[model samples]
Target chain A: MTPRLAWRLLPPLAVAALLVAAWQAWVTLAAVPAYIVPSPRLVAHTLVADRALLAASLGITLGVALQALAVALVVGVLVAIAFAQSRWIEASFYPYAVLLQVTPIVAIAPLVIIWVKDTHVALVLCAAVVALFPVIANTTLGLRSVDPGLRDLFRLNRATRWQTLTRLAIPSALPYFFGGLRVATGLALIGAVVAEFVAGTGGQGAGLAYQILMAGIQLNVPRLFAALVLIAAAGVVLFSCASLLAWLALRHWHESELPPR
Target chain B: MSAAPVLAVDAVGHTFPSGTTALTGVSLAIADGEFVALLGPSGCGKTTLLSLLAGLAAPTAGSIAWWGEPLPPPGRPFGYVFQAPTLMPWARVAANVRLPLELRGSDRATAQRAALAALARVGLAEFADAWPRELSGGMRMRASIARALVASPLLLLLDEPFAALDEFARNRLDDELSHWWRDAGFTAVFVTHSIQEAVFLATRVVVMAARPGRVIADLAIDAPFPRGPAWRASPAFATLCADISRRVAAAAERAA
Candidate 1:
C-alpha cells in the first residue's frame, strides 16, 4: 500500500486499539467476573486455547455462507434475465421476489429446516433466501437501464435478440450485479449463522453459531466472544472477496470501478 | 447534381401517436454525393425528416424511397450521428466503434481492424483502447463519428452532431466532416439549427418552419470545395447567409 493509504488507515486501527485497551483496563480495574464480561486478555487466551474447535466450526459456517452466496448469484441473475426478456413474466413473478425479500428469514428458517431434512442443506437454503433479493433487484434495474439511443442504434444495425441480450443487456447489468454481490455476501453470513441458531444442529459438523450457543449456555463468555470475532472476520473476508471480484471485472472500463485520474 | 436521384421524399409526412404533427407534406430529392442541410428552428421536424430519410421510422403519410426502392432493405446501409455522442460507457473506443460490425456478424479480427481504421480516419487511432469516460467531449464526439463511419455507409445522416461543442471545436469538426464526406463520396443529410453551420457546410440548404413542419425555401449554395475562413468572410457567403436568415425569420414569423 502507498504511504497515503497507510496514513488514511491508521486512524481507524488506532481507535480500535485504544477501545480494546480501555476494555481490558476496565475489566482488570473493576475486577469483573469472567462469566459476566471477560477481559480482552481472557478472550484472546480462550481464542488460542479453543483454536481447533472454533476453526472447525468456522470452516463449516464459511462453507455454508459461500454455498449460499453462489446459489443466490446464479439464481438471482437468471431470474433477472428472465424478467428482462418479458414484461409479462416480470409482472407475474416480481411480486413473489418482493414477497421473499419482505418476509423475515428467521420466520422462514424453521420451515426450511423441517422441509430439507439435511441440516447443511437447510442452512444453505436459508442463507440463499436472505441473499437473493439484492442481486435480482440490481441486475433487473441495470438490464433495463440501457441508454435509449444505444438501443436505437442496435435496432438500426438490425441486431438479433441474442446479440442485443449478450452484447448490450449483459454488459449493462454487470456493475449492478457486482454491487448486489457485495451486499449479498454479508447477508449470506448473517443468514447462515441465524439458520444454525434456529436448527440447533451440533457435534462434528456444527457451525460457529452452535459453538457460540454452547459457550453462552456454559457461561464461557471468553469463548463466546472469540466465536463472535471469528464470525465477524469471516464476514469481512467474504466482503473483500466480492469487492476484489468486482474490481477485477470492471477496473478497466466501468465508471464505478475506475481509479481517480 | 444528377438526373437520377439516389433518394426521393415525395410529400412525406409524420404524425406522432400523441397527435402532434411533426412533419407535413415535405418533399425533397437527394442526388449522389450531395450534402443537403436541413435547417430549421426547434420542433421544425428537421430531425423527423432525417429519421425518415434514414428509414429509422416510416412516414405516416406519403413515401420515401431509396434508389426508387423501399428504403433499400434493412441492413448496415447508412450511418447516423445523434446530437450527443451515445457511446457505451463500458466499452473501449475501439469496441464501441466496432459495435455495428459486430452486430452484423463480422469476425472479431476484421471488426477490430475496421474499427481501428475508422478511428484513424477521425484522428483517434491512438485512443482506441481508452474508455469513453476517459475522453474529452470533443474526442468522444469524434469516437462517435468513427463508430458511425466504421461500416463505410453510403448515406450519412447527422442530427446536429456538433451542436454541443464549442465554436472552435464545432468549426474544426465541421471542416473535418466535410472533407471526410468529400473523400468518401457519400450522400449526407445534415440537420442543424445553426444558419452559419448550414451556410458553411452544405451544398444546398433546405429551410423549414415550425407547427406542422414543412420546407419554406431550398437555396443552392454555388460555392466551391475546401471552404475556409476566407469563404466564411466572402461577400457571397454573407449574401447567402443573410438571404437564408431572412427567409427563416419570415417563416418563423408567419408560423407565429
Candidate 2:
C-alpha cells in the first residue's frame, strides 16, 4: 500500500495490539480462571482449532444477511419510486412503513418463524423488515429533491413522464439510495444475528449466534471468545463491502464520493 | 425592416398568486432578427415577461402571440438562458447540450453531431466530456448557452445570464454573444440591469419601470453592424447610455 494508506492503517492496529497485550497481562498476573474470561492467546488458539465449525456458522449468518439486504433494496426502491409518482400514495402508505420501522423485529421474529415454514425465509424476512426503512425514506427524499430549474428545463423540452423519471429522478436518487444501502447492510447483519438468537434453532443450519449460545452454556470460554471475534470480523467485512459498493457507484460524479483534491 | 412583426405582446398584465402585481399594461412588438434588450432594476418583471414570451407561463391578462398564431411550446421556438448555469451536474457537457433533441426523439447520432456543433459555436467543443463541476463559472455559463442553442431556437431569451460573472468575464461573454447573434441572425430579447450592456448590444433598448413594471422608454440605437470595442469608445455610445441612464433613474424615482 502507499504511505498514506499505511498511515491510516497504523493507528488502529497499534491500539488493538496494545489493548490485547494489556488484557493478556491482566489475565496472567491476576490468575483469572479461563471459564470466566479466556486469555486472548487461548481465544486465538480456539479460533484456529475450531475453524471448520465456526466457518460454517459464519457462512450461514453472512448468507442470511446478504439475502435480506437484496430483498430490502429491490422492494424498498420500488416502493420509493411509487411514492415519488404520487403524493396521495405516499400519504396513504408512509405511516404503515413508519409503523413497521418503529416495531421491534425481535418481538415480531417469533411470529414470523412460527408462520413461515422455512427457517431461512423467516430469518430473511425479519432482517428485511429491520433494513427497509432508510432505503424508502432516503430514496423518496432524493427523488423529490430535483432542482427546480432543471425541472423547468425538462418541461420546456417537452419531456414525457417516463423520460423524466428514467433520465432525471432515478439518477438523482442513486446517491441517496446508495447511502441507504450502506446503513441497510449493517442493519441486515444485526437483524439476522438477533433473529437467530430469538429462534434458538440449532444443528446443521446453526448460525454464529447459535454457536455463541452453545459456547456460553457449556462454559467453553475460549470458544465463546472465538465466536465473538468471528461476529465482529463479519460485521467489519459487511461494512467494507457496502463502502466499496458505494464508492464504485458514486466516485465518478457524486460530491460525497469524490476524493479530496 | 419588415412592416409586420414576428411576435407581439399586447397590453400584458400579471399578478402573482401571492397578490404581488409584477407587470401591468406591458406591450411590445418584436421584429424578425431584431436584438431587443429589456433594461430595468430588480423586481421589474423582466424575467416574468421573458418567461411569458417563452411560454413557460401565461400572462394573467391580455395576450402574447407568435407570428399571429398562438404561443408555441418553448424548446425549439424559444430557448431560455437562466441567470445561473443550471446544468445537470450528473451529465457531461455534451449530454446536457443534447437534452432537448433527445427529448424531441431525435436520433442519437444526429443529436450528438448537433450538440458537438453547438458546443463548437460556444468554443466548448474540447470540453464536451467534462463534468460541470470541473469547469469554471464562466465556462459553465458557456455550456449553458451551448445547450440553449443546440435546438436551433428561433428566439433566444437571456435572463441576466452574465450578471454573476466578474466584470471582465461578463464583458467578454457580452462580446461573444453579440457576435453569435450577428452570425445566427436569430431574434434575441436580452434582460440586463447593466446600462453599458444595454447600450452595447441592443438594436432597440426597452427601458422599464418597476413596481408593476411598464415600458417607460423605447429607444432605437442606429449604430452599425458588428459593433466592437471601438464603438464602445465612441461618443454616440456614451450619449445613448447617458440618455438611458437618466430615463431609468427618473422611472425609479417616479415609482418611489
TM-score for chain B of all predictions: 0.96, 0.96
Residues B73-157, candidate 1: write the lDDT tens digits: 5643688898899998888999999999989989989999999999999999899999998899999999999999999998888
Docking quality (DockQ) of candidate 1: 0.70
Write one digit per residue (lDDT tens) for candidate 2, span A1-261: 988669967998899999999999999999999999989999999999999999999999999999999999999999999999999999999999999999999789999999999999999999999899998999999999888788888878888999999989988888998889888988999999999998887998899999999999999989989999998888888877888888887777889988789
lDDT of 1 at B45: 95
| Cα lDDT for residue A259, candidate 1 | 69
Question: In candidate 2, which residue pairs get closer than 3 Å at backbone N, Cα or C atoms, i.e. clash?
Answer: none
Model 2's interface RMSD: 1.2
Model 2 CA deviation exceeding 4 Å by range: A2-8, B1-6, B73-75
TM-score, candidate 1, first chain? 0.94
TM-score of 1: 0.95
DockQ of each: 0.70, 0.68
Off by over 4 Å in 1: A4-8, B1-4
Chain A TM-scores of all predicted models: 0.94, 0.94
Q: Model 1, range A192-257, lDDT digits (tens) per residue? A: 999999998899889999999999999888899999999998998899899989989998778787
